[model samples]
Target: MERQMEPWWKKSVVYQIYPRSFMDSNGDGIGDIQGIISKLDYLEKLGIDVIWLSPVYDSPNDDNGYDIRNYRTIMDEFGTMEDMEQLIEEAKNRGIRIVMDLVVNHSSDEHEWFVESRSSKNSKYRDYYIWRDGKDGQPPNNWGSVFSGSAWEKDELTNSYYLHLFSKKQPDLNWEHEPLRGDVYQLMTYWLEKGIGGFRMDVINFISKALDLPDGTIHPNNLYGDGSPYFINGPKIHQYLREMNEKVLSKYDVVTVGEMPGATTDDAQIYTNPYNKEVNMVFTFEHMDLDSGPGGKWNVQPLKLVDLKRNFEKWQLALHKVGWNSLYWNNHDQPRVVSRFGNDGEYRELSAKMLAICLHMLQGTPYIYQGEELGMTNVVFPLLEDYRDIETLNMYKEKMEQGISHEDIMSGIYAKGRDNARTPMQWTSEGGFTTGTPWIRMNPNTDEINVEQSINDSTSIFYTYQKLIQLRKQHDIITHGSFQLLFADHPSLFVYKRQSADEEWLVVTNFSDQREQLEWKDCDVTSKSREIIISNYDTLNTNENTVEIRPYEAFVVAFKKGIEN
Candidate 1:
């Protein structure tokens, strides 16, 4: 029998680059395609197989690149179309593939299609977007925008309101229309034909909405209502995605990951099941939202290690053979992982490595966001004007209007604002990103934490990430082994085991700042010969039953299944 081959993406590691903050080669203060092309060597050195580039499409900068104006053209600030093509070619030259951001749920109101659709009620493109008549001098529904306020925007020319789940400038597309879906398919085909690797879809689950556009339940403390129930993973989401796969995705040999905000484990199984052919995997927000209070993302709260372990165990076992999972710690819209989940002040390097080992050792593909390998921390801008994220600014303004104190609002922003991940990449101490002033302020601690410094130090977080990536490629157990969570209820320790037919790997991580002990009776290794694969600490000691774990320390021990002591 012929040997079977698995998908290349299953064994690959991805690195996400927020183009606007990655690098700037033209001294224009904004990262561009040419800038990314210049750093191909750096990414190659990191051993990442795919570069998940955030949106670089034409936009008005209202919500950064997320609100795209043109799907085919590159943003002027990020360079021309030629530069983008060069980036694709250059990245490929270094054995790296580029994954573009697919933002089909909505487009900039300034887009030609939206402009034409809103030009007149009788226009041919009017059905390209979601529009409905107002109700009693108000919006069509009491839906709230993800960026706050109402989700409806009135248009005087058509005498109607258009739905925008995010920014008013981003009018949601009418996926119910056949022609609109065809157009999106064609655009996707264009990129895939251009030698791009895959796509990281933006809010893909929100593309389908309830046809009635019903009003959501109103929260007592809020102005508008929660509209996610009507839009997220709607009635026809599967039909639309299956159609999309058949029309565009199935023909290509590329990977696809959808960013689903409200997706549950069951929903994810349906979306990512190989037989369904919807997507290769989905980015679930369950783990990310664990640190939030009932008030939502801005309501900052401490993360419980037990809660995190249980959540991971549930997903790992639920999707083991049924589907796949996409693991990540930080992204463009999230706060820095080190500052949020690890100790960024005293044991930043050790904590960062621990977090990496905990996630990478799981049974899924891992993503490393820009500057995450350097152990970047959250930036606490002193003033509201210093913050640039629309969500942050809107929350501050709305809270102040409700008689909230400046100190309280600022504290939340410092702890959970999206701008925490938008700081420029720290390549060096002296304005490494650009010659001109950065669009957003650089983190003040960039002097001590940067790629240059990290790469030189053997004990830096960058090397730890590099070693983890290398391990995934070298060991089949890391990719195909079954996962089992040990010490599930431990308050400060995360312990897991991955076992294959003839190999077993033990991954232990200390989530707290204090030393802990791992004494799992079921995970005894007295007779098996053990090898320390990778560790954050310089020295380690382990006995047959229990191991003494230092503060924020992590290590992986490998054993040959049939070998004796």
Candidate 2:
């Protein structure tokens, strides 16, 4: 299990910033580039090496900047290109690298390329986006958009249908076209020239489309049927990616992490091979989308400890020796990890620390979402109108049109809505994310569990994360170490060990609300080599033979070649 340490990314901690709510600098009630500039010191103090900023490109805000109107221009709401340049310089000065979001799979309808494409069928730029004649005056096939229904939207002026996997305003680009591919490559090169560290590619795998464009099976709830399987990770995806890699990314020292929605480990290995030169890493949704059904429906399933462990183990084992995994629970798209994965009811502090223990111990780069360390919980929306996420709002409207009861829809929203995660970041006791009211309502619980409170509490989840990150950096074993899951079959316990030539560590976490125990018979430690390094329950007496883990308790035990186990 011993190994030699390597790259800093293998040990670095990445912090995700949803600029719209991370902070407000100009009192515009919205977070911006200057706002992010003000927070560099905070992130540097938190030991963040990478700051992953979500889309700040000019957009219509139809999908909150995902619909990019201009790849080169910064959104006016966020800041100007000059402001971004200053922010980047400032972050670099503070030793924090900036990773910008790359949303190239689609572009806004207003984008110059899309505008020209939709202008006329004979337009030279028409090939940039996917467009086809309607079948019998209906959408081209039954393909559906991720937002609600019909991924294919009709362009009345052109008498054609354009593909939009997400929202109608965000039309899918045609990667099959060489010119389009060249343009994207140039965009990457432009940013690299500007000194950006890397890219968090948005829906990167969706760039490929089904060669045959065959109709997939239909679900009762899927208005346009389940066609994502056919459209995602299409035939020539890797080919296009390799071309991009050669043209742009391979020329730089950038670390590219792609957002692959339905990518498997096999697919991951091909794209992220160190020698392959396609991508540096990828973010898989296998664990994040566990609560959703095959057709992207929220099924309201309580996360079982066994299921959670299984998902974690799958990725850990699959990518252990192949490509790297991006270990995280919260992002701009997902709810807070403390609330989603941990028990946030009464023991939120313990649960928050426990979640961090579970994730960071895995062999990968760890991403900390803004406000996540504060143990942020989901928003409590009294009405559907309270939500601001475009996806949530669209789904609500679509479901209502389908005759779904408002009460039932509200219940579904409570269980799984993107808005729950998009609420304003709680920075003060009064939840003053802005001088005026925030763009969206702050979670009511923010009044008590804000940044102001956690920054002052040594035992707060925020500080726990700070310590965890510091440990990852300080100890080579915690980073670039060989990972082996211990007690892998344990019902309620997730136990793993990280080992390097110089050190070894055992990480054990109880995912349930009840006390759990690990029998030495099922553990991987030897009689002469283990010592308790950290324990959440504070009952880590090295004299004990069997370890007792309280509800949501976690312990990290360090081991040397010779020590009493």
Candidate 3:
């Protein structure tokens, strides 16, 4: 089957909004859809093409909104469907598209499907979810869910074990069953009919499951999976996605960004290739999961600039050949990239600009998380109790059970907890989000790092992002150009170029704190002049042959067809 070329999401900038933390409308401490609606003007000015909102569906919130009990209804905490429609309408009015989170891998146990599936074996909905008979009165296998424990939970009512790749309250759906798969397609179609511009499919790759139900191996925490090989990227995933794409996604001018953990570029190519017509692009976890270990546990692994540069270059090259890439540094699931990857301690502005240049200059669709443009850092939670994210809480409890001391757990929490990203977005220093208490604690540094502080500052990271986005929109080469790495092996510098035969841009950045000289080697430019398009550092001097970049500095230079420096 030949897939028709259609709307390309690779050319847009997606801004992720964590609704519960964005802003408050009714003084309830929680941010609502109306609040998001009110902020459409701001997003418009920021030049965001799409707004990828986190899940706002009806849920038990055990795993936040990932534990959806009802796919059709908006959560009471978020707003009504009317409010959602209004938000979409308002965003559309301002030229921003809405992409809701699609959490189809699992559903809250309270969902009608799960409710009926657990009641009796002969029920019509029995096959809606994965249920297996207990083996010697135990769970079917030793596979552990992502949050921390057994992937299977025994149901007292039915005397059966059901699969849950996350919290037990959230049971994995049985995609192998035809009717269940049909229901997923129906749900997606329903959303598209309601005018959602796209979907951010959660754990999309895990929808496919391998045949063997065997327990791979056991770890110290009684965890298995380390066993994800059996479940991730299942056989029927492509079939299911193609059906949805053909029936729903392809019908409208819509975009789909799949969130598939533990996927390599080759794996991504199968799903995201436009020729396959499954998904437009996928958010690969390679860059985000750098802190996790092969031991199936979260550990503190600080990413290096050189390593980051290498990984970015590889993905850019690999995807350019087949499909497109969805570029992002911070999303709702990970901590702020400025604090994690860049030097957020002192050279915050310069580091933020450098990181933005590193991602924006790449040949991928860039995504910006709320508060990211302001160079936001992680919140300091003195105690675990202050955090609201369920994954962190589960890991904390598991470590405690394993006899890991409080200090060590706290250290790990400091390094890689989702709560670091879930803190309320700091809108202003005078509590711009709410006069009352926010749904979550604001990062202590919000007083200085808020958007209000960065908006007008010419040297601010926020302005840098604004310029980068404008540059991308203005230049066709930056959008569909070929990327070639220049100083890839250089330890302190990350330099690359994007060219489209007619135009060329040289992007250079100093990843370290100390100053470095960027010597453009082996390239002869015959152009009359090279113009400085954008720079995190000061202006370039005509006298110097070598470009001097300060600590964490970044810049883009536009070389005319025959320019010489």
Candidate 4:
């Protein structure tokens, strides 16, 4: 018998790059593939293993690149196909693989298939999208769009409505159509053959909706109905994924992570289980929604530290050996993590390092959103016109129409808007992103919190991330060790231990501004040979049985199992 080798992705750290905000090479105001190519050395210096590049496919820009108009063509604004290929090659040269964003659940309404599907009721492409007749002059179903209002958009030409789970421009694809599935597989093959590393699937679980297209039940204090039960993790989802794995994913030496919005631990166990051959891992939203109230994402609230700890503990324990988890705190659709989880005002650098240690030491492939390493804070634009995201703008209009005050709506946007993560990366103080005007406003604090300054300063947040990534490469315990939550009920501390047969790594993080004390006895750290592997603080006070933890402090201590005090 032979021991199975761990997958390459298990030990890799992924850095997500929203290309439009990364850099601008041609003074076009939009970051292009060439711009990304120019930053390969910068990414290499950061010690990232993979770059998960958000959608660069041809799009109409309705929902950014998520509403792709063409699957095989590169977006005109980003670059030409040649530039994309150059980017892949250039990144590989520096030992970094490129992972493309796969958004197949929906396509731009201007897509050829959608155009033909709507041209006539008898068209061959009509089955590619979900369409049906209206009932009593209303939409086919009472489901609401994720962006706002109604999910169903009426097509005036065909005298019917097309289902769009997100923006009206993004029409949901009918996976029930065999040819449609085949088309998707063929496009995936097209990319895999291009020497790309893998894919970060976008809202993949929503692909297989119920064929009945039934009306959803309305929730309290909501104008529209909840259709998540019908579409999210719907019937035949597993079957479709199995088919995809068999037809395309399994054929490549590539990793796939599904962005499952409403998946449970049980569902993920099946979706990412090696035996199932569905996806390599899944991006669960449970932790991301901890700050949201019952009303949902726009209804923002402060996050409870215990709740976050328990959530991570659940996923870590559930997927110990059965499945895999893709760990992330910020992405293109979420606000900056330092602003959300840590004190971004006074202790930005310290809290950022602490947060990095908390997530990177966990048992999963960690994803670092661009500029998050520099401790970027959330942007609070004074006027609504400064926002560019469709979801944020739509929510504001809908809420205001319902008599919500400007201050109330702006507060929510300030706290939870997707635009926070979409701001142009602060490479330098003098508009490092573009020579021309940026499509979206840059964070005004870029002068003080830019990548140039962070990279130059050894004590900056950038070095903390670089060190964490390097540590993950050197230590196997950080990646494959068994995870155990310590001080689970602690109000201001997130403490956990990762242990193997002979070595153990204990991670301690103080989530608050006040100083906290940790008695080593509580953590069962009786070993005398324990060493402080990393810490956000300059120094630490420690004895045989106790250690004093400072404000927003974090550190990892490694212990040799057989050592005695």
Best by TM-score: 4
**TM-scores, all models, native as reference:** 0.98, 0.96, 0.96, 0.99
Clashes of each: 0, 2, 6, 0
The worst-scoring run of ten residues by lDDT in candidate 1 lies at: 519-528
Residue-by-residue lDDT tens digits, candidate 3, 161-232: 988888999898888888987888889889888888899999988887765577767655564545688878
Model 3, TM vs. native: 0.96
Q: Top model by lDDT, which number? A: 4
State the lDDT of candidate 4 residue by residue for 1-565, as single tens digits.
Answer: 1224768898899999999999999998999999999989999999999999999999999988999999899999999999999999999899989999999899999899999999999999999999999999999889998888999999999999999999999999999999999999999999999999999999999999988988888898678998999999999899999999999988888889999999999999999999998999999999999999997887898899999999999999999989998899999999999999999999999999999999999988999999999999999988999999999999989998989999989999999999999999999977599999999999999999998898889999999999999999989898779999998998999999999999888899999998888888889887377888999988777877789888899999998998765
C-alpha local distance difference test of each model: 0.91, 0.82, 0.82, 0.93
* Candidate 2 lDDT tens digits, 214-272: 66677776667678787667788888888888888878777889999889888888877
Clashing pairs in 3: 208-234, 209-234, 526-562, 527-562, 527-563, 527-564
User: What would you estimate as the lDDT of candidate 3?
Assistant: 0.82
- In candidate 2, the residue pairs with backbone N, CA or C atoms under 3 Å apart (3 or more residues apart, or in different chains) clash, namely 144-151, 145-151
TM-score, cand. 4 vs. native:
0.99
Candidate 1: Cα lDDT at 446: 89
